[model samples]
Target chain A: MAYQFDFAPVLQHSDLLLTGAAFTLALTAVGAVLGIGLGIVGALCRAWKISPFDRLFGLYVEVIRNTPFLVQLFFIFFGLPSLGVKMTEWHAAVLAMVINLGAYSTEIIRAGIQATPRGQIEAASSLALTRLQTFRHVVLRPALTRVWPALVSQVIIVMLGSSVCSQIAAEELTFAANFIQSRNFRAFETYFVTTAMYFVMALLIRQLLMRLGQRFIVGRPR
Target chain B: MSLVKITGLHKHFGANHVLKGIDLEVAQGDVVALIGRSGSGKSTLLRTINGLETIDKGELVVDGAALHDGKGDLRALRQKVGMVFQQFNLFPHLTAGQNVMLAPTVVKSTSKREAEDIAKEMLLKVGLSDKFNSFPDQLSGGQQQRVAIARALAMKPKVLLCDEITSALDPELVNEVLAVVRQLASEGMTLIMVTHEMRFARDVGNKLIFMHQGRIHESGDPKTVFAAPQTPELAGFIGAVQEA
Candidate 1:
């Protein structure tokens, strides 16, 4: 016999799902901006090999990239408190997402920076541009343009990986789905909606980033 | 008065002595053409003048600034010297105008309006007035080299260094770039160029120095040097080019 399909029970808890979606978006928004910012600094340090920070960021990137994202979130939420560094589940979740995305983007952006032609640097130097000026003006935008697709994919992966925040009781979209399923016993329907919500978010985000790349990285047509 | 002076200059890459105990002087308004076979250290000598390569031992003074091992500020020295490369290394991301304006605005702190005006004037000088908004990739190799010249001239350098400026261009395109350099030469812009264009060098350059085995193998008036070479090395170089 086929199981009966139902929508009423899951639809009644739409408010919870909406709140979860909003929370997950907020986490990703904050994580992406700050994480990419961190990634730029990390990439600079590693690419130019800027002394102690280069070594430090190299270690951080290696560790984060090699380990599982779930374990990172668990360590931030569960383990940090034991070492007297306590934060709410929300803070721990955001921190985990930032660190995770930051590590991935650092490597991605570094590859772009390394591909810069030697002549470009010599030209900038010959023009009397300082080291900082050359990097900011001549080097960065092109580098970002080269690796933007990979960066966008990495960002989307981080956004989806945020579902693990629910395990820490962070009240993101997945947590809402779990809460609704537990209450109404409509597991399949709740999961289906949650999955759709994530797919839509990813699509929207890719569009937003692509538009941004065209406007800023590639420059507007005169 | 001499604008550039080099005395007992020496440069080595590992054990390979690139420039060995060279002495030279370039006066204001002089056009010096450096020509030689590849690996002959002519390019290395030009780079040393621009502070791109440091001297191992000896003195190099350009525009009253010393550029030896560790004496003078490189930025200050570079401000008075402009360099154009064979590849025409225009900043790919910026427009031609932006590329020309970047150094003046950032390094010299020229206002945006002033930098734009200077960029326009320099682009006009290079015959690229219509390409102000074009990206480097959008321009042909000759046009790109002209923009690179405009970018350098925007700095108002006391002297310009051209390292085989037209070597990478197509034969048909070489004259367009050479014409701009020719104009600069006629207008009395001090220039030191490393080139293989024998006829152009004879016509435009006041002095020609043939570098062989890291030394000034032959040096004199360009017409006389081409007409009567005192060294077998110089004669062989001219012969090889003619055959090619």
Candidate 2:
């Protein structure tokens, strides 16, 4: 039998697919803000290296980075229930995304912070700015500016990685595709359309984050 | 009384003794030039005065704030002593105006509007009125150096330390930066400069100091030291600078 492609059956559930896409977008947006925030803090803890945070964040980053995101998602979604800390599937997915992003970005932001020139620190100290003030104004901003492109790339990668949330049947775009295929029995058509949707999504998230970076960071000198 | 008084200042780096029992006094409005070959500790001496480098031994006081104890509250001393580096370390991500405004706003708690006004005035003083919004990479080496000077001046330091500020500039660019410094000198701002520019030292410094082997080998009026060459080390140093 000659195989024919049909997207009509999948398109029939447009409302379901659109809702799934929206959920995916929502998941990524929330994950990004929380993740990047966690990343900044982890990076600062590593950079400043104040006592317990030095060893703590270092170990945290190392552990999370060494482990696969899928395994971490499984541990959060499946493993945590045994420990008596229960959460919904959506919550677990967001938490996994956040934890993963934090570890990855810690190292990225640390590299940016380390590249700050010796002259800049000397200049800040000579001006009598406090250690906290120096990092907040002088050190952190340029560091972020330097590594912005890397940061944006990581954000999109995490967005794409959000597809794994479907493993727990969290009802993201991929889950919607699976549901449509199961209902219509057009497995090839459903999955192919879903893959294209993902491609479009990755591109959109990438452009949107880059635009945010431009508005807040690039070409606007402090 | 001298504005800056250092009696028996000593500094070490691991096993290396960089400054050996240095004794010097800088009066208010004195343009003092520290001249020596590399590794003579002239730069290190300037660094210690501004609390950038710690002293291994001796008393170092700048305008009533003593740093020899290593706990002498550098914050207060730093307000009165500003330093400009050889590298022209203007913050790369900030405009010249913002670079100048940072210290006052952050350290002194000046309002943003006030800091901006002061930054503009200092940039004007450095003769970079048109370059207030330009980033360091956008400007020439000379203009960047001038912005650095304006940044240092924005702190309103009583004694400005210049650590080979012009040594990093190209020959043509050196003069433009130096011209701004000379104006600061004539305007009665106290200056302690470590310089390789012998001609500038002879012309601008009211008092001259020569360092050799981590000690003040000779210190006197510029005309006397340049003409007489009291020590063979200084004479050799002058000869070396002339040939290069």
- Give model 2's clash tally: 0
Name the runs in model 1 displaced over 4 angstroms.
none
TM-score for each candidate, following the candidate numbering: 0.97, 0.96
What pairs collide in candidate 2? none
Model 2 stretches with alpha carbons more than 4 Å out: none
What tier of docking accuracy does candidate 2 attain? Answer: medium
Q: For model 2, how does the per-residue alpha-carbon lDDT over B35-89 read when each residue is reduced to its tens digit? A: 9888999999999888889888898888888876555888999999999999988
True contacts preserved, each candidate? Answer: 0.69, 0.80
Please write out the lDDT profile of model 2 over residues A1-222, one tens digit for every residue.
798878899899988988999999999998989998898888888988878887898998989989889899999989999999889989999999999998888899999989999889999999888888888888888898889889888988998898889999899998898888889999988888888888899888888887777768665633
Worst 10 residues of 2 chain B by lDDT: B65-74
